[model samples]
Target: MAEDRILVTGADGFIGSHLTETLVRQGAKVRAFCLYNSFGTRGHLDRLDPEVQAKIEFFTGDIRDSGSARAAVQGCDTVLHLAALIAIPYSYAAPESYVDTNVKGTLNLLSAAKELGVKKFVHTSTSEVYGTAQYVPIDEKHPLNAQSPYAATKVGADQMAIAFQRSFGLAVAVIRPFNTFGPRQSARAVLPTIITQIASGKNEIRLGNLKATRDFCYVKDTVAGFIAVMRSEQAVGEVTNIGSDFEVSIGDAADIIAELMGRKISIRVDEERLRPDASEVERLWAATDKAKALTDWRPQYAGREGFQRGLTETIAWFKDPRNLAGYDPSRYQV
Candidate 1:
């Protein structure tokens, strides 16, 4: 790790920012690939510890462009591809954009990695690719059933990543994580929506599909899983599930958050927040045995107790005035 030079795509976003900071702290030479913007903003990376920020080489470009992808991967020995358009609702309105960025962008990275002979190429995948769970704890062997355009594109990207390894002998791996919630998360996610509204002193929380279940992994655990996958030689050409084997329904999660906040609240079903009936994923729970076998990685936060502990920490962070300053809880975020 200390000898590795890593390139992290989507280094500007929630999980990406945390991963970048951790890599630098561990002494890896980190190059952060942030989406180019006119404002010169580095997303959450801009708020990282000054020392950590100083250590990262921030490159701004579009992942959809092959030229940009190659340039970013040119000198890096390893690449962690986390860049993608992730919002499900937005994906319905812009399915073509999802294909361009998630699928084509992934092909661009895979091609570059193969050409450069990267030692390890870890591509990020989401549990959404599984759609509604057919079994209690979904595993790597689970059949992919994408209900949304976002998930479909991810499935395409993931297969292309593995195909590179099979076809060109590149060292490629994919890590699929379940619902990940933490500080710095945007309101587009349900947990953030719940926490933000509560922090804003709202009693009536707006939500959708309360019956759906999720396996929520804390950000720190997910980051550790990514690092584990990166270091394991057994992970090449493999897809590992990184999640807690614990499930909580959306309705229950909101109630739990309210309990932790010591606030009694009611969930108001927001019509606009509901997904199309056929597009909704009714359940998700990950089986993480493969991750443990590969890298001895396990969620530090596990089960009901750990879930609550993670929520407590997240609540404390979002409750801070400085942290909550930019979040608008009044509006429904897609």
Candidate 2:
């Protein structure tokens, strides 16, 4: 058979960049879509090894514009949509922006995919859509309660994608990943936030609510899940969760990373960092049985291993004078 032509939107970000690299390694002709910036920055994709960078076709554009989205999707067999404003704290400050970028942007992509007759559209989702996890292991059918503006927009985006698949036969699949963490992750994410601070020689780590528990998956494993979903016919028009079944509280996670680093640090809760009580998803744990059955995808990295790997890689990156220059650990990132 012919090799798949793949377009990965948000290829500039953490997981997207890794996914783009993986596709290229697997012999896919990849067009990497990164958000346009005045600096002509490619984000993490720019940091990828030169060999991988050479294999990718780069396009700078905004997902909010249908013309741009359609242009990017054209001539591609599969479209992996991962672009969005993902910071929960920032979403609270500018909700309309999230709705525009996440919801409307998704609408534009789905419409373009439908028009372009793409073979498959993998829609990325987050476990936050199932707020607080009323059930132990959140299944696909779990009720979606958007606790934060970010989660609300993602919920809107996922529903819109599925609607197009069912109503217009767009061949869309929703892949919900829970807390993917790794080297390229933004410091705004909890894992990177804590690791960066401690690695910066800080004796005290400032954080938000530490009681909330989360199910984290390594970035590579999460990317693998995406590939599995794309290859599986059974995943079409279906929602599959990519996550480690294990759960850990923020406090415990911080301690684990600190212990791994051989550092004894005091963790202080920053008021500005805490989410509103009602808006906070107290707990999130995912059920991957459907994914295992449909895509035969299972998380290869457990909590401790995943956490250590992410912490080790992230710490090494942040320790680099160049990478550290990009991050301000003392400042509370949105």
Candidate 3:
């Protein structure tokens, strides 16, 4: 696997950056596809060690553009498609962009991978596609309910991947992860929002939907799951879920972070932070039986101890002046 040429789309993003680094460390020749920007930024990839950065062949392009997507997929044996418009709030404001990027962008990759005959094509999906849990532990068989436009686009993307596999025999594997969080996550996410606020010396933590519960998996664990899915022959044409079965409410998660920071903080319900009631996902708990059965994969980080350790590492990163400077705590990112 190390000698295989791998292309990771969205290689500049939070999870994508970490996955790229992991692939490089394991001795794979990686081609990283980052969103083209005027400032020539590589997003979180710039934060990786200089030595790791040097090992990757970087390509700047938009996934929505067929020519760019085709160029990146041409020589690669494996393609991990992670690029998409991910923010739910932003999706409400701009649904067409989501369709173009998430739906059509995915179509671009699927078409390219099929034409190029990539050995493995991994498509990234989110638990948001499941919406609120209709049952205690959401599995691959759970009905997909797109409660938000962002989720709807993802649903379309996931189906497109499946369609490609059935119609064109594309070697596609879909991995749906539940609430992945850790260092490099932007403030738009709840974990980073709480950590950044507390690290910035805010006494009152502003949040929304405290009662909402989620199964939070550390970023490393989430990346590991991706690797597992990529390697397993059984994973081909299958949608596997990668998550810790443990669940925590938003209010309790905040309290845990405060405890780890060694500071007591007041919690405030900020109206702006709340999502539209209908758009909110009330609960998400994953059932990893299929992932375990198919790939011999199990989450290394689970429950309170894992959560605390991940939070500690995340808080440390956000506390650094260099890193903190990149974020504006005063403005609500979204």
Candidate 4:
């Protein structure tokens, strides 16, 4: 038997970069498929340790291109597809792009993976796919109601992944994570938006839908869940959610973050930051039982205490002057 060689699409993005580094450190051969850009920017993957970065086989190409997709997947045993346009506000502006990248790009990868006989294909999904949870602890069976174009594209991509598995017997495991937060997160995300504003010495921060609730999982926990799903044969053709069982409203979360940072901060709703009335996902709470039963994956950061611990670490990372320099806290990030 040959060792499993992995190809991680979107290796330049936040979570993908971390996963790439972890796989390299674990002595796995990884081909990192980063988006090609004129400036040669590798996104967050450039931040990895010199030695770790050196060990990765870098393939700079666009996931939207089928030729490039197959080239990256060639000789790889596992495909961790994470490339997609993920900003909700922007998705509202350009939905066609989401379909091209999220749905079509996934098709290209699935086609390539099947053609090459890849052993496993781990597809990424989001809690946004479930909309404003009609029931508490939304499980794999929860009805999907995409509240935004971004979520809609994810749903499309997820369905395509499952379809490939069912139609061709291509190994696929869909990992749906709810509100993962930690270091290296872009400022566009709610947690990063709040933390960056506070770090930049703002007493008042602009926000939207603070009452919306979320089950926030730490990045490490979420990444571990993905690995567990990849290792489990039973997870093939299944969807598992990675999240903290606990939930908190965005407003209360801000208060907790403020307390953790020792900063007294106030949040004011920025009209521009608010999503359209019907598009806002007001609540999300993940039922982690499926992930546990299928992959033996448990979120180390669960509940209010875990949330606080995760925030403390995240705050410290953002407080570092070097890390904070990458973001402009004054600008409203979409």
Candidate 2 ranges with C-alpha deviation above 4 Å? none
lDDT of 1 by residue, 214-298 (tens): 9999999999999999999999989999987799999999999999999999988998999999999999999998999999798
Q: Model 2: per-residue lDDT, tens digit, 120-181?
A: 99999999999998988889999999999999999999999999989999899999999988
Q: Number of clashes in every candidate structure?
A: 0, 0, 0, 0
> Once model 1 is optimally superposed onto the true structure by TM-score, how far is the C-alpha of residue 182 displaced, in angstroms?
0.4
Checking candidate 1 for backbone clashes, the offending pairs are none
- Candidate closer to the true structure by TM-score (higher is better), 2 or 3: 3
Q: Regarding TM-score, does 1 or 2 come out ahead?
A: 1
lDDT of 1 at 330: 88
- Please list all clashing residue pairs in model 3, or write none if there are none: none
lDDT of 3 by residue, 1-334 (tens): 7779999999999999999999999998999999999999999999999999999999999998999999999999999989988998899999999999999999999999988889999999999999999997999999999999999999999999999999999999999999999889988999989888888899898898899999999999999999999999999999999887789999999999998888899998989888899999999999999999999788888777887787788889888989888787778899
- Error (Å) of candidate 1 at residue 142 is 1.0
Model 4 clashing residue pairs (backbone): none
lDDT of 4 by residue, 1-334 (tens): 1278899998999889988888888888999999999999899988889999999999999989999999999999999888889999999999999999999999999999999999999999999999998999899999999999999999999999999999999999999989999999999999999999999999998888989999999998988887899899999999999999899999999999999999998889999999999999998999999899998788888899999999999999999999999999899898
Error of 1 at 80 (Å): 0.5
Q: Which residues of candidate 3, in runs, are more than 4 Å off?
A: none
Q: How close is each model in CA RMSD to the real structure?
A: 0.7, 1.4, 0.8, 1.1
TM-score of 3: 0.99
What is the C-alpha local distance difference test score of candidate 1? 0.94
